[model samples]
Target: MAFTLTFALIAALAGPSVAESRDELEKKKNGVNSEITGAQQSYDESSKAAGDAAAVLQASQAQLADAQANLGSVRGQLVAAQALDAQMQAALAQSEADLAQAEADLAVGEQNVEASTKEVISFSVESLQSGDPGLRAFNDLMNGANPTEFTERKAISDTIADVQLDRLDTLDATRVILDLNEQKVQALRDQVQVERDAAAANLANITVLEQQAAAQEASVAQLVQANSANKAAADAAVAEDAALISALEADRARLEAEIQAEIARTTPPPATGGGGGGGGGGGGNASGKLSYPLDSVRLTSPYGYRIHPISGVRRMHDGQDFGSPCGTPIKAAADGTVISQYYNSGYGNRVILNNGVINGVNIVTTYNHMSRFAVSPGARVSRGQVIGYVGTTGASTGCHLHFMVLVNGSHTNPANWLP
Candidate 1:
């Protein structure tokens, strides 16, 4: 399991903050897409090697299947984790830089505030007429370490900046700016701590994964050599993994059903400018067709019946697995409301979008194996907006988008809708 560190903010931000968030999201999305492209090339090369390993293996079909299954996973998981580590490293660096800059800004702001306060105090002592408002205002500003007006900061700022009669107003404005700088510094410091902790955890996981990858890579040749004892070990490991996935999926399916029911119940009549039920029509912009959830789609697996990689059981795949590396930007397939965003041990981090009816078929889409989500559940997203980053989570062998679609409450091929 990868460390899908989702840092959620609790503030009920509005107005310009919303626009600022979107701009930041777009910038981060672009960065992830660029990094993922490079990482994807490396992951593909390892995948190709796995295929070539399978072709050359001279073993029983069962042995080959089981061994290929585990080896591919081991190799792919390592690469995916390494890519995630790289992204964490980049983020950690940026956070450190931000923290430094914020501290520097605060220091400068504090100096300016102190200087302005002293200048106002010294000059106003001589230049003031008796009972002047400027002298009284300066008295209030200096008397308290944090003025009682600090609680009424907005009112204080409006009075001072709008009705500037003297240098005292300039001093007052400097103090308000200083307070804002302090808040900014504290926020940056908190961000730095979080990134540092996540980076450390990621590095620890990668160390263990690297060892597993090396052992699995070596076992590929041993499995091909038809070692009976090693074969049993591989089978056991595969079975254990499959059982875990099965459990997670079972729980996810139950929860997902509840989520769908919740959406349907909350949805109002379409005649009243409300959306449809059963998976479609939460309604942002889905009208006629759907867009691909990923910018670059390399279909490693397709929707249909296929032999399961871990369990070797033939079952419906139910989604299109696009081979993207960790940190790849995942887009909304259509303008829709995010009805659900949650993590399953088997699905990793997933976002279910309730896209409006397309043509006549009510449509919904899901993006899975996410490193982190940009949009929260209930957010109305536009088509092609970045919603999350691709990651290797749950039962993933590597970083990819396991994109699924449902039409009117029935599982359907994503390819049928994606252009």
Candidate 2:
């Protein structure tokens, strides 16, 4: 009896050889995890840089378009100014011609006045030399040959005085017209100068707009180039990370295959009948009497149909989430063989256990978002054994246990199985 008890104690204390093989694999997995972490960090930094570059490119493109539009408007202004300048020049030329013609007409008027003065002086001298007008009139009346002849001589003298007065009036009118022409020419020149100044101002504005457009174009080109470079870097970083992850997964698969072989070679001795009755533990017993997977449970999410937080798609939620502090110890829900432990894209560090049949239905439970594993594949674990720790790994928002139960390969709500 003493020897038999000693053998039983030894068997209970030591783990199977298959478990030893799993330890080596877990160590390699940790190494691969470190590499994945490094790759993910690189990818995140590159993606942020790419996003910043894209923002700069967007702003630069908008500025470039505005500058181009402004340049077009400025060019139109310049064209309009040129047209106005040409019109002003033509007007100035016309004004100059008008002034020149007015001066020439004044010159002709002055010469005519001078000739009229000479004619009046010659007539005065001839008339004075010929006779004194009042004395001759009186003599002719006293010794008149006929009254009709005397009346005709008086009428001729009156016509001569009228013609001399008309010449003086014509000279006065010419001087007035010459003065008006000078004023008109000065006013037209002032108008031309104002138009010229406006044209110059518009041209200067157009030059500034052109320079701005050129500068904006250069900025846009630089930003676009930077954006392209950043995008390429981001793409390459993501691709490299994907390749590394693929290679690591392959390694994990091979290691798992070996673990499965080791389990086959070192299969445990079979039980003859039902092993145990209900026991006090943190997890379920062999009788399918379930226990809480943690010492204290706070439901973060419930199992049901719901919209996904990230993708916003309606899908079935196959698990229950329990909030926990980071690195909190997690227990197995029932007696089970460790089926697999690996990194999952959505589940992070995961461990799935086949907990044997319950009520004629195959019961499988999964623990996800673990920081690391405490057990290994192919190891037999009793209820309440430490299987892993809580973490925010693999598509998780925070530290939590995503606990799931499956029945015969189909997912079922974990809440239904939990007490």
Candidate 3:
């Protein structure tokens, strides 16, 4: 019994009657529409997220710029410090030279003082021992002779000794002056040493500053690299967002087309036995009128001014073509009275229906390329009802339904009339 029931259920599901359920078709159509909407929403959210990322990247770039500027400032300071250090080094070297010169001057002064002392001692010995009368008298006067002799000789000797002594004193004064100059030089040397030490300390500071500058520069470089990477990511995100938008748009268009097709399939055919003429009862209902003349067919040609497929020339095409198997069912486009069902030079096996007077305006619909007609002249039909079958009739090419819409007998693009 279970096996029999399973077989029955499978048979029921496989049947054409089950496959053609309107509710199932509607559900599938809604599902497609829903997918399209969901894709569009996700695309929008991704785009917004990409924009936010871009903003963050911009801020990071700005920060990187500031970091670079600071690095440059540090580098400048480092350079200045290096220059000052060089100058200080030069000054220190000069100071060392000055100190050496001061020591040499002091040595020279000491040597001069020793040489003057030797010369003074030798001159005194020579004055006492000289053989000349004045020198001998001078020497005797120094030894304390008689009063008159002592007075004259002592005066001459005293005068000579005084002169010699003054010379020695002058030499001694010169040595003292040299010693003072040496002291001044030593003082200058001390000052220079102090300056040199300070300069060395400053050079050490410069070294530290250089290190800081290098670190700053490295930071700037890192920031630059990071900023570049961020920008690239942001650009990629933007591109992805754009691509998603395009995909969403395409999906939306596909879903809209499917929805329109579903609506056409499910809606009941318009009544052919209408009170007034023209495609359908006018006003808003006209907008909802079925657009396609047939179902389950591929579009062969679209309505508009198009290049003639055979002639390769710009030509005005007044209708659309739906390629279908021969004898495929064609239906009335809208509720309207059948105005004419006849053949013509260009349109063979054609039918013209007056839709109705809608908003006080008359509209007509035309169908061509019929293999066989189901309705007769003056017969009424409803929308979606098979009125004829597809054929390659009238100025024909392949098997297709040639459909047209006329507003007051003027051919217009059929897409405008169809949903």
Candidate 4:
């Protein structure tokens, strides 16, 4: 959020060392304006930084969300891989059991074949040893017993050889079955290994995604913190600027009040006699003229619109300036009451004398840039009475007297009333 300070320049207060002169008032107002401008610049910079931080935080949050989603997806894949691995392990176990059974059966079949072969060998040896070449066997075969017993004995020897051959054939078939079982077990083990590798790869991906999410979240937090601080600084600068403007306005109000009070005090009393020394209206003659306030009068500046020396802006020169040395006695123009004695920035040491109304005009004469005051407020004096001494006390370049004539609280040409 952005805020601007919109305040008017304040008038100078009526205080000692305050802007008692127009030059000083202008300088003071400009100073405050410069401060306001500086603060506004600072606020703008801070606001921009906060805006940038907000953008960064938003992007970081989006990245974090993406990372978190990826992590979740990878974790799911890992779980599936792990489940597949478990199933493969179970199958491998079953295949291994079948392979073990086939091995045991083959071992038993070999033992049976060995024992049968041994029995046949023993019988053959006995038969060979008992006869000379073929004599005993032939005699037994020809005259041992009845034909049925001989035939049975010869069948037993033939059956023994056939049985041995069958046992060998059975052993070969069992070996083939065991080899096939071992192949099945090896395939299952390979499948389990593949599933385990897949699971490991999935787990690694999940870990990487988790780390990315954490880093993105941390970046988001830092952005948020910086944004908060920037916003605070902007707010503080704006508030301070507002406070300064308010103070300036208050000072202006106080000065206005003082000016109004001075005006009220200088309002002249009702007219009475035409002219008299020590009375309210002095310096009036058959010609009806007011006395000169200064003896050595050199008009340094005139009344009316002119460019200000310091401000360089055209403004009303409300008073007339007289070139005079410091400590030059400034006398009253007429018999009047000193209604106001105060200090002003534009008019350093000032005195406002109220000369009673003459020719239906309420005459108020102001003397400015005085080095010192010889009289106090409410003092009554005749024409030519010294009220103050001339000096460059207020917003002036050199010693001089600034004289003004106010008719009914408004300024008028002093030349019209001067003799």
Candidate 5:
């Protein structure tokens, strides 16, 4: 019944949040939809570089999210405006129908009033010209000379008396009913006009809302465009990195065997009266210590399953991504020896550190996508020792470190192990 709708009402119709006048809201919504169509195409083509698109996508997502929010607010207003228009139109229709019925009843009542007046007029005219029939019947009954004649006259008088009162009552009732119907008809006409005016106003407001749907944007796309640099960097990193990605998928057993051997070595007995070489860290006993592989940890991606940005493949993401630029120092998480340092078309320059058992389990950590190695195999590095420099040499995008941790030689969540 309320004639006005506010931003809150629009939210109820569109969703549960946002605030703005209807026109501005509608315009932003249209802009949001268009922006998404364009952005999706860009994202798909950029993501084709072997999952590198995912790295830069985080960088580019802010603007697009804002656009969507603006659109959501506007979309709600349009629905609310349309709904109000419906209410106004329905009210106008009901008013018009009521007006028509009242007019029809008034017309019928007027005819009945006129007919009743004519019947009363006819009786008055007949009385003036031919005298009163009821009075004459009464006189005949009073002058009756025989008992049988008197009885017949009395019966005729009684009938005329009853008919006279009935005729007058009909005339009075008809006039009163006619007057009341006339008043109802006038009131209905006034209500119809009021509703008609309201409906017109509602329609005009809707037209304005529709026009505003073409609203312009000033700087919404700039945020998403800023991601180009990061996206390009990711592309170059993954160019031949599919080999590394495929190795992880198909050559898992071979890689694990080599790693297991390096971490299982015992310290050789002092080499026959010579300075001992670096001892291999065979992780088995608990030392109750672990640290972040990078000095600064900015987690970009967490350990879990995710759909490939472009391929839509469901796969487990086995490591945590730290936003470390290329050349950032990779450090040892615990006092342990290097498991291995190697390079291949599949795995870019990488190193694994065996941080001997902590919390009653053997812990091995790998730092991947490094620019170069800083430690030799079997080096007994202490906690926080530089092992390698972060790089995007492997199948990845952006300059970041892909750090992985294993418990008892099975890959586990790196976050669980890192400080």
Candidate 6:
């Protein structure tokens, strides 16, 4: 009898030990599974980050290409300006040469006229002082010149005078031409100077472009480094996830072994039907009057501080946006009467629902961005009833239900209350 008692006591202690071991294994398995899930989430986030980095790198590369193109354009302009400067210089040189030739011709003409005048004066003195008649006549003939001779002499003198005059005239014309040429030369010089200045400016711009390109290259390098880091992080996360999954598999195997062992040890266990009966009690006194607007959908904005997306300025979002599609249905969150539903500047199409009391607190909901309103001012509404259709109208990006819950005119995040 003592032996039987000892055997029964040992069996009882061993049975509990087996059960405890199984339970511990199950717990470990669950912990491992959790770890695996966490690791997978981390891996996914890291992968997304790597993808974003790659996208940024691609954008940077495109920007670099554009910068290089602009640099090439600037260089082309500089080259064109230099070519224009060279052409202007050639024009100026030709103009100077023509001017010099004109001046030289004028000087030679003046010298020839002076020599002719002296020869005529010497001949005239010799004719008037001669002693012999024939000699005197000859001198007189030489000086006065007979009809034919004088005519010929006069013609020669006239020719000389005309030559001188023509030379003088040529000089004057040449001077005029020189003046024009000089003006042209000055103009060409000015043009060349302008071109040179433009080239210099372009060179400066090129330098700036080069610097900008260098900066962009540096930025690209930085992006590359960032991308590399992101990729490494992603790889690490993947490796960690793999390790966690392997660990979970091992833990599951251990749990199965323990559970099998527990089954083997337990035999002919007493069955208490299907466990304990689930107890339930009836009840009650649940009575409360819920007074709230049902289909009130009118409100332009909500009361709260919000940052402007583009400007990054912090301002109060006075109301909510509620306008939907042209004929979309709008609903009221609670039972309330519509206080006002009118078009305003900020609120294109608006509706305001005043919920009397929700959980012992007076509440008001505003809906904006509505296409049209089914109810009018002072209209009653019920909960979960369609009041209006959603429409994207007035200061709205798209059709969305802009629901707002206000407590005493103060705005709160609608996401917290809406189901």
Q: How far out, in Å, is residue 412 in model 6? A: 33
lDDT of each: 0.63, 0.62, 0.64, 0.59, 0.59, 0.50
Q: What's the CA error at residue 372 for candidate 2, in Å?
A: 35
Winning candidate number (TM-score)? 3
Q: Which candidate do you rate higher for TM-score, 1 or 4?
A: 4
lDDT tens string, model 3, 341-401? 6553345677656565544555566788787777654444566767788887755778888
Q: Give the per-residue lDDT of model 6 (tens digit) for 94-116.
A: 65565465455545545555555
Clashes of each: 1, 0, 15, 8, 3, 41
Model 5, residue 29: C-alpha shift (Å):
60
Question: For model 1, what is the C-alpha lDDT against the true structure?
Answer: 0.63
TM-score-based ranking: 3, 2, 4, 1, 6, 5
Per-residue alpha-carbon lDDT of candidate 2 for residues 58-106, written as tens digits (9 for 90 to 100): 6666765766676667667656766766676676667667666766766
- Cα lDDT tens digits for candidate 1, 1-419: 11111221111123144443333222222222322232233234334433433443334556667767887887787788889989998988988888888888889888888887777776556445444444565566777736655446546545654544566777788889889888988988888889889888888888888887677767767666655443443453345445544644554455444434433433332222222432222454434668888888899999876755653434457678999889989998877656557776656788867665667765667788999989875466788899999999876888899988776556578888866
- Residues 71-99 of candidate 4 have per-residue lDDT tens digits of 56666665666676566667656666665
Once fitted onto the true fold, the runs of candidate 4 whose alpha carbons sit more than 4 angstroms away are 1-23, 131-419
Q: In model 4, how large is the Cα lDDT of residue 296? A: 79
Off by over 4 Å in 3: 1-15, 121-160, 267-419
lDDT of 5 by residue, 279-381 (tens): 2234422345467878788999888766533233334566788988799899877766554566645336777665554676656677788899897654557
N/CA/C clash count, model 5: 3
